[model samples]
Target: MHITLIVPTNGRPSLVSRLLAHLERQTLHPDHVIVSATTPNDIEVRPDISFKVSYVFGDPGLCAQRNRAMALCDGTTDIISFFDDDFVPCDSYLETLSRVFREHPVYAVVTGDLLADGAQGPGLGFDEAVAMLDAYRPSSLPAHVRDHPGAYGCNMSIRAQVIGDLRFDERLPLYGWQEDIDFTSQLRAHGRIVNIGQLWGVHLGAKGGRVNGVRLGYSQIVNPIYLIGKGTMQRWFGIRLICRNLVANTLKSLRPEPYIDRRGRLKGNMIGFAHVLTRRADPEHILKL
Candidate 1:
């Protein structure tokens, strides 16, 4: 049961260091560990680790870096664990994740609780908002969140066979955002995606700078439309309904963000729509914090 750990980075040495240290401490060490940094000089792994270290540099875009790393996993690698550069793994991560997959190999994918870390009391102004968004989130307790391909890219694993025909959609415009969802949705169509509770991962939880301003729509807007455009959705969500959802979400998100002007948010969305409609807009270019 040799597992491949694939992590991608864009030159964040601090987070990368944290991830490597955590991996070194894993109870079931991976068979191979590969890091894909955006630049050649970004590889600075310590030489004393027990596993293999392979680095692929200069691959730009989210999916490209990941795809390159996957290749490094090689055909013999049985399982591949994808982690964001930011997540610090617990000692039991590999043991538990591999255990669940070994027991339930039929599922195409599995994800664990990406519990949010830091400032966890209810007093934070964004607390309710975070709750609102996560309220409907599919949990992986095995009792639930156990039979869907909708898993987060960070801290998830896939058996090599299930991933042979699937790859991240590199056509996506940006480095971050809804590419994870889109990929998961595609995997769901082919097989089951489960939440494996015995395995848990923590998100260091950086929204970048978007926390200061409401992130109007990308996940909330464009990709859904594109999914509908590609006929990937189970039901049609017309432009009108999508707009309404976007506006409603904007309001909810705006509650804690003082930087966004409510009126201008709507106005800017409209303007952005025109650009999208006129062939001048690219969802990848949307601002992220």
Candidate 2:
């Protein structure tokens, strides 16, 4: 299968470097790897890498950058896989993905199990991440592959032929919250979207190169409402999401946790909820926050 990998990043060169190293050890390699950044110089490429690497630049939003990278793919590319710059895949990651797609012709999208920092908590160190990848192995069988509602943007792959000309919603703006659900939900019309437990990976959950807690918190509320208004999300689902985030942020803010901005997120969620109550909620308000 002719597969291409796309990673959209913003000033996270060191993390990208580690991801490249993991790619080198993959049992199945991509025909091409596209690294999309805010500027061409933000990425430093290693000439010793075996696969073909391409560096491209675009606006900083994740959705916009990914779309730019997808446009650069060769027309014949069969599958396009999206991986967050902070994700560290197991050695058999690509091999497992390729096998699922090859075996299930009707599968339109596959989302891998995204573990939190290799079973370690947040702020995962580089050496620890590499070590975890080195020692990883598949722990389950065919039962691991099952139907899912949507793809997880951190680690998901789509069949290029099946999702022709589709791109992420730029209106979702920075961090592009729920962009994965919005995009993958559209693909369900074409075929099944499944979660492959054996194709697991760890998300470093690095806080850098991301929007502030306020903006993310705003997205947590506004994005869902916007989708619901657009008919992309069910009203019940949107309400549940709003209530859950509000309650979590409210409760957690009284005593903030390490590596999390409980207070800031609570404030943002309250602001968004107020807007919604006043009938003035807008997704664009996230930028203003």
Best by lDDT: 2
lDDT of 2 at 181: 84
**Candidate 2 Cα errors over 4 Å, as ranges:** 117-121
lDDT of 2 at 226: 90
Each prediction's RMSD to truth: 6.2, 1.9
> For residue 38, what is the lDDT in candidate 2?
92
Residues 1-289, model 1: lDDT tens digits: 7888888877566557656765777888988888887786555667677778788886566678888888666678778888877665556778877777777756677777655643222112233323432354444454444665256776677777766667776655445445666666676644677885566656654343221112344334555556556554433433654667566646755563443345444544564566568765555545441
Provide the TM-score for each candidate, comma-separated. 0.74, 0.94
As for candidate 1, its clashing pairs are 148-193, 208-289, 209-289, 210-289
- Tell me how many residue pairs clash in candidate 2: 0
lDDT of 2 by residue, 167-272 (tens): 9888888789888888888889899999978787778877787777788788889899899887777688778978888888888788877778878888788788
By summed lDDT, the worst window of 10 consecutive residues in model 2 runs over 114-123
Question: What are the per-model numbers of colliding residue pairs?
Answer: 4, 0
